[model samples]
Target chain A: MGQQALCYDGTWKGLLSLIFDVYAYKYSISAIVTENNAIQSLLFTSALIHVVTEDIKSARVTKGIITSVGKKGYLELYHVFLSEKEGRELLILRTVQYYLGVKEQASKNYAHADVLEVKKIVKSVSRERHRMKAFIRFQLLKDGVYFAIAEPDFNVLPLISKHFKDRYADQKWIIYDVKRKYGLFYDGGEVQEIEFGTENRLDQKSISLAGHESEILYSTLWNQYFKSVNIRERKNLKLHIQHVPKRYWKYLNEKIEMGG
Target chain B: MGSRIQEKLSILADAAKYDVSCSSSGSDRKNKDKGLGNTGAGICHTYTEDGRCVSLLKILLTNHCIFDCAYCVSRRSNDVKRAAFTVQEVVDLTINFYRRNYIEGLFLSSGIFQNADFTMERLVRIAKKLRKEHNFNGYIHLKTIPGASEELIFEAGLYADRLSINLEIPTEAGLKLLAPEKNHREMIHPIKYISNRILQTKEEKKIIKSTPKFAPAGQSTQMIIGAAKESDLQIVHAAQYFYTHYKMKRVYYSGYVPISNDLRLPAIGTEVPLVRENRLYQTDWLLRFYGFEADEIVNDMNPLLDLDIDPKLSWALRNMDRFPVDVNRAPYEMILRIPGVGVRSAKKILAARNFEKLRLEHLQKLGIAMNKAKYFISCHGYIQRYADQQSERIKHFILSGSSSKYVKAVSTQLNLF
Candidate 1:
């Protein structure tokens, strides 16, 4: 009726299904948040009801949005959802609302605030996804499962799963996001979302398989090769840090000064 | 690998760092048969302290050159540690590094150990072993040896994603001054042979369909800057020649890091001409993507690029009549010509301006550099603010107005070419 927060299950499809009902039932809501997220906001100052996720309704909304703005624009909106930033749900609704109000395509309307904001957010999310692809460093364990741990700034583990799965189709590898405490494990045939140890503080030794000789050898060779290729006359630590930021130094085998 | 292999890797990788072509892109090598790798746009896996990308495990098969090229560090006369890797050792290193995600793939170059064909054969053997024995689908780039037979180069193209031969100097006269035996004709022979074979193979593939891609990434070359007496004009003309003649994918400009104390070249402490190198690269970008001819950027009239401003902005300043371009009405080409607008910003303008007349807010929102762009472009209801300003004043306004952070960065880091 009045302005209220609507809670959806913790998924992009759930949000789309919730938006579908928001339009179909004419429900007035201030924010569309995850059921877990809505609890925090509802405790202070809003009314909310759990919206069940329906595959059929979500499919209808997906088609409607695709018809308004093409697949490329739809992907831009989806990347904003994957970003999971503050006020992201509201921004998506507004951009959808603006496009639905117009006859012409509103995706490229930089003159409008909502469209421009979506462009900015999509760029940032795309950058994080690309960085995850680049910064992921896999270490070979004794069991021969190539293991890597990343704590990206965003929830990009889900975004980069297909890339790793496709590239290393022959090998078994696991990419664990310590911050999210979830991982994607590819077992040579298919990928499965997994959960590793409780703390996510996998100090190098915890993951390093015992008596695995080649792991240490390759890591050492990598660190040595990294240092050797640098031209001392052109040493620019500032530029190096900009490309491989300080926050990711711990995760990378070459960036670590010394380790197991 | 053992400690012996590690030591050899250090020596050979250190020796090979000067080549500076680390890209592992432009290859259509797909991962079939559930094997190792597939290349898309290249990834820079790590950066060195010098801020150069370590995309590939760029290493040499051996550092045992017989030539005494003055600018080269591994010259026969220069006293540096020498090491060699057996073909099997190189294959193991590449496969293992690739598995651990430490690199895109292998970039194998070598110092001439014996005659040209012998050295070229060794390089090809390493590539062939990786592709055939291991079923590796990784990006491989090999350096074409000067005076090597066409058969070796052809074998290399079948395995390597890309092949390159370094011109080493901008002009024949400059090359002869430093390295007496080397000439442009010798380098051109290999490039011509490869280009011709690439064309013939491409034609055969149209009919055969299973011709098995022959160097899908195409060939590229590198020339050292600040090594010899050559102007910006000569350097650009040489690049233009390669682009026109061979359809070269890229021409790398590696600034001369004083590696040898040769009497024929600059003293060891001579500055690296980093600013000049950066400008030349910016000019290179214009030639490749920004619809600019080499002569337009630098000609007989103006042989040197301006150090204070970028080449694009310098061009816009010199051609003063082209300013105040209408944002909404101008075609995509004219919008691209605006000094501060990059390819991304130019595309955004073309897409966004179709709905309505672009205003100041819209232009800023599109992420074009408004600090420099505002003087050159006009939008809805906005008159040119500095209409009658001279080129010198505009250049100063653009430079001094830019953040001090950029100017400070130029001193330390070499900009990407």
Candidate 2:
């Protein structure tokens, strides 16, 4: 199958160049690889190569995939690329390209299995987005910076900004997507991206915030509340663990001091 | 006093955990002009290790009591360490917790300390301090002491969002045997008094705009299920009485967890019957929201909720003549009688069918779970074949797996927490 070896400025324009080359090739392309990182090196052996140019007309045609699907779809495509699922990157590109061609008639053929598959993936992502809103727990860090760690099934961190920002307008907070290795930090006004470097440890003991009196008092009170609320007669340890999994207990204030 | 406060909070909060009326809904007051008040959808600031929502600063004024309620951990004769929070201590904790947004407000219930009036006065003082001295407009749900006077009950309504007077047992004999200090008259009198005051306040509000909201969120009561020999029908009847007579916003059913070794209560080996509680809640929803009456749901003949199936489905099976409700022509109330159709699905069917004569496909598109609804409803002259041909067999088939599915759904949601 015909392939493209495209290199652009690591921007949407660069991605669009690759999309334009797919159609221009006039041969159904097998894959497109970015040259800066040798992504999927072994798979590129039998593929044909075509260099991408900064052609505005071609780029605009390619950008139409984003315009047709809206921003949510565009971000999903980005996540699909980041997910590194086998053939996912190619599938997203192909899906976007297919969506661009049949934007208007997409809803008419609801019975089609391909459309159903796309809808399921989109819906699953949306569900995870909503679940994160319900489950995200924030902890008070040493610097009075409220921090929370989440490992959602999908890339939901980007979607959670509007909620946290609105609800906690006065507080400085950081919500780290531990699985994604990146976090969003809001400094009481605006949010910015922060990366947890390779040396950054995930151990709770290592990141201790020593002298926050209110945090300590709150933690103690929470522990008191937790101890008090459990009905001894109806103590179902199995059911309790089932509800609040031991996995999430590390960051939970009530469960933090009481080691699992 | 400090150690006592901590000890009491620990024991009482543990005791009070099973009481699930801590939900703060219905009130719309926001942080008015700078004083700390929030009317947002109540935030659950903490989750216990068991993962239950900690929306309110739930604690008891004291775990010390004069009564020996069989189902209560705080029963006077129990050998557990007892503790009590002084009025100042409770007020301080509430204000401190509220400032930190650690809780919505206080859910203050107490085991009878000294006497009913003394306990009620202490609880009232904490609430008064929170409202007047601190100017707190947060949600507060206080459990009304059964024998507390009308004046204290009035103050409770004035300061709290909701006041609850739990009718601990369904029958008077059960109350007398299990909790001698508490009587049927003591519980009902306060409920009736509060109900009257609530009604009067509402009427007064219509005429006078400046009148304060008296229990704006309204009153609710709890009934301990599985403790006494009361059937689900009798329990539901009590709930109906509270709903109609007392004008209670909710009748919370807490499955009896036998905490004391009293022969008067159910055996300790018996499970709390959470499924029974769930079934009761579903039936209660039908009563309040779905317009199903109590006696029609569970009569003296059919006294117990069929543990195998939901009350709605069981009702549908018994009245098989009402089967094959024509979805297109049936009213909203009639459509609600269909087994799988919930309030939302019924509304959707009404809205969608108005546009066109609904087929099975149209019903599915409206998000009705067709597997359950098909046996109960007909669409565009299409009736379920087995619904009439093998009615008994179909009923058994539906009833068998309903409880398992109900358990699974609850377990799955619990996992999400």
Candidate 3:
């Protein structure tokens, strides 16, 4: 056989199971591809999809990676997983391979190429998460559930849930990641991960409900306050764009002019 | 018809914009059973196009003042529309703004409407209603009126997280020249009282867990720069005194934005001293984070910070015998003093070098700004290019191309040890 390709579902657990398959069959794999990846295999290479996602095997692999590289490294691994970066699954597997022979924290040792690659991805994902926390603007809904939407470059909804849960514990709220098509809903008591699968594509106008008239009024007042506080003499749009980039302006109430 | 909340917000927020203290940080207040918001490690909701953080619902209780400070936009002599928010109005606005997550909390200041106590009492009542009645646990920063009664200031601290009294001008002589109605003593009295109470409450809390926190975020003050004739040395000295004695959290420098044609202040349409303001902030950071003293930053000999170079680099150039700090063997303090080596990177160096010797590449990997730190630091297998040269030559090499951009020529004298 020429170079062999192992194809699996594009999930962390699936990737872990593929790693188990490599060791189990003594398979000298040439490349690993996920189901959604668009990269084509070389001609005349045997490619097979590993059907089952073994839970026990994935758990063992996760524990081993965590024990080798600390909790922060493990979290970085997860963040890179959520990043949906191209060739990320294979990169993560390679990073784990580097950790196999080392005992001390390899994450801090940036000399390792695998660790450096993972660190760069982790930093970018963390920045996207922080930007989400700063930019999410909740508009009051008619049912008293404050609703906000974001289309982050990375999957940051899982990261920002805890912060919003703590700060807005007394109120009912919903934060929907429009790009991911899923959301987090927090009642007065607990928060639940929600998904509206294969249904209506909820756009901004569709969700800006008419149930509460004060939503428009409050947003108008906020825009007014935002405009008045800015000193006309020290107008620095370049610096402002550096902090709150144009990519986030669609979600910000203050960025939009009122009565338009 | 009565003025809408939108109109009042516009007027009062515009009036309060010049105060320059928009921070909603340093307080960790948790929401009770029915509060609207909680503050944990302050969050900036948004940044205005001017790049200032809109962290709080910063507004004045009223814009009607008795004193005519020449530099103030809200001075009694200025022809601006006057507006006032009632006690209930202020409380309602804070709660509504906070619920929508538009702010971390409230920063409430007033323009001394009736008297010091009268204005301060209303400020205290608003805080009381937010904490006791509304059960709101968001961060609150109250601007204590100068010459306000001790009792009112104490009560205000009970509910607010931070209390501030602006020393608008740095020196007494400067204050007398422009803002004659204001004096240094009136501002310093409330600060002293608040500082003593903060210390006493800390001791009580150690003994009794239920002693209650008093201004738990501490107090901060502001001074307007370039509005009066005070040297950078004078400003740094006054800031050091406030930080050392009162334990002030911050001393913000507002680069006086010219408002009107007054002989006492800069003429209207004169450019704000933004570059000077930025240099002062860098100097302040050196004092707070980098373990540099006020005199080390600016003394009688060097009264002003070099406009082209940063304060830390200037200090390092003046004291060149301290250069070439070994990244591996240097203590945390010495590493911090090196140019472009921040607190985070210094700690990282200490941590990573324990595993292996740090080379120049290792320092770069740890995210040190090598371009500036290269002349001041030495790592394993690393050689400083200008180590054998005099400090004047080194400074010249760094500023060769940029010297044309600055109005003042580069200093050529080499201070030898």
Candidate 4:
């Protein structure tokens, strides 16, 4: 039983500083905390240190590891940190710190268990990235802005912007990841990040123009098309929901008006 | 006619809605200048309640017909709302819908407005206007009127990305009894004619190097199953003939939906045999992609597809002597016979195995669902004996699992919408 190790803040720079501390102390760090813990570790001793603020030199050194090992290395360390896999994270951190000391030896194909583990984490992240592409649903907002909300397991918001930008070039849209509290907004051109506090919870009734004349016509025409195209004999309700999950039914124009 | 057009479209599009091959695929034509829209691989704007993609502006040119085809809602004696679109109206609709990004292009069919030639000419006029007047480069699928004049059929081939003529029933006798106006020769003649035109166009393109694309997405046809007494074997035979002789892109089998208590058609209460439709599609894939022939899969003696098992697994079960193909050493085609290995998964196995000798562990890592594939394939030196030993029992086991999987997929899909 011992007190949990603490770091200054929960930024990328703070995590790197913790890695540096582990290397300097020659002792594997269990965890880094921004706050105190009630339970203490009995078998292993813990060290608490205020995280050093990121400077030009430290930033340059961390950027070098990322640039050399590529984005996969950085993401592996991030996922392990998020999962709070103490032993795995410590091993990865120590390996990265050692590799940084010998930059030429830090090839992506390096024969190390830590490197392979990082590849697994990278694979998982990429799978999550593809899932977000498939599952993200866009709701047409009142001001003609199509907004979508997702809560992907990983930070995939930045990766999916290119797809929407190319596909919906004529429209303005926003895809927000509520879990990460971040969003990507496309304003008929390039995509940009809209900060967390800038937007509020979307009001469904306010966004819908059902009461307006033109909106009613558009909805009626769409429903006409929807109803016309449905094959009653082949009404496999199961297959319909698979392609378009009911979770997205709230935002779909045809579904919303018809109460499908 | 405009009011009539709306009424018929609602009825005919509702009828044509079940045909899943409304896809505008296989041709890659972009709008050259400031044309209304471009055609890419099947751009689905939305999915209907049945989860089918709605990409094409699927509609009939005219639903008024002289023929009394029992399976069709637009049959002459059905007493349904009748309508026909003017050439200009179809052109306007295509342009407007394309501009709005609501559809990729038009899938135009007719129900014999006057005769085959007359109806075919009207369809040709619509395509001509869309291409010549508007310079529209989007996908156009024109249903060839079976007995249309050769000249009119040729004109349709010039403008359409794909041309189709439905073999509404599987057997000649069925066509004779149910649809007296539609004979075997009438239906097969246009398919043969279009196939020859397509081949001739390809030859012309080779010689002059500037012939226009002729049915560039290739000719596809539909067969209405369960409307006749003909077995799956007969349907597969006709499909094979179309594929080999006509060089068809696809033969879509639509399960019959009995609309009325017509004596010529089946009872209305019976289900459309969706499971049979699913099995046919799987077998169709085998024919196209897996180098399987209709005769090899099933024959006249083995007329009906086993309702319980998928066509592929049924084929594998019958030929159990070809079981336990060595995954590590067998050729890609041989590995394809293993029930669970899809075309994509088989290709993945081939690619990944080249990097290393694949064991059960390696196959698992390569994303092969071992439970299904393991029964049919051997990894390294290990072969699964259970599937071969209790082949009948294994067939039932696998089929039940597949049925449940489909059920779950359907449930999950329903929950989504």
> Relative to the true structure, how large is the alpha-carbon lDDT of every model?
0.86, 0.71, 0.83, 0.70
The parts of candidate 2 lying over 4 Å away from their true place are A1-136, A141-145, A152-207, A235-247, A256-260, B1-8, B34-37, B40-54, B88-104, B131-138, B200-210, B351-371, B380-382, B400-417
lDDT of 3: 0.83
| lDDT, candidate 3, A44-132, per-residue tens | 23456453588998888788878988778788888988998887877887787777667777777764567768888999999889888
- lDDT by residue for model 1 over B224-290, one digit each (tens)? 9988878899999899889989988899998898876677776786667677878888999999989
Model 4, B1-417: lDDT tens digits are: 334445655766765565557778788766655444456546665577777777788888777888888888878888777666678877876765554345668999888876889889999989988988888888999999888999998888888899988887878888888888878997888888888888988899999977888888888988887777777888888888888988999999887877878976778876676667778898899999999989888886687786656778788877888877888789989988787788866876776565456777666655566667777887775767775467788866665655454554444323311
- In angstroms, give how far residue B97 of model 1 lies from its true place: 0.7
Q: Which candidate has the top score in TM-score?
A: 1
lDDT of 4 at B410: 41
User: Considering TM-score, which of the candidate structures 2 and 3 is the better prediction for this target?
Assistant: 3
Ranking by lDDT: 1, 3, 2, 4
Instruction: Candidate 2: give its CA RMSD in angstroms.
Output: 7.1
Across residues A1-260, which tens digit of lDDT does each residue of candidate 4 receive? Answer: 44345454555566676666555566545565543331344322244655575665346647766876666566566655554333544555666775676554353432344654565666666666655554454445556776666677767676667755654555677887777787899886689998667456643454453233334434444456668988776776777776666765654555655532
Candidate 2 residue-wise lDDT, A44-109, digit = tens: 544536455577844575457557766555665655543434555456656766677764533222
Q: Give the range where candidate 4 chain B is weakest over 10 consecutive residues by summed lDDT.
A: B408-417
How close is every model to the real structure, measured as TM-score?
A: 0.96, 0.74, 0.92, 0.73
The TM-score obtained by model 3 is 0.92
Instruction: Please provide, for model 3 over B122-149, each residue's C-alpha lDDT reduced to its tens digit, 9 standing for 90 to 100.
Output: 9999999999998889999999999899
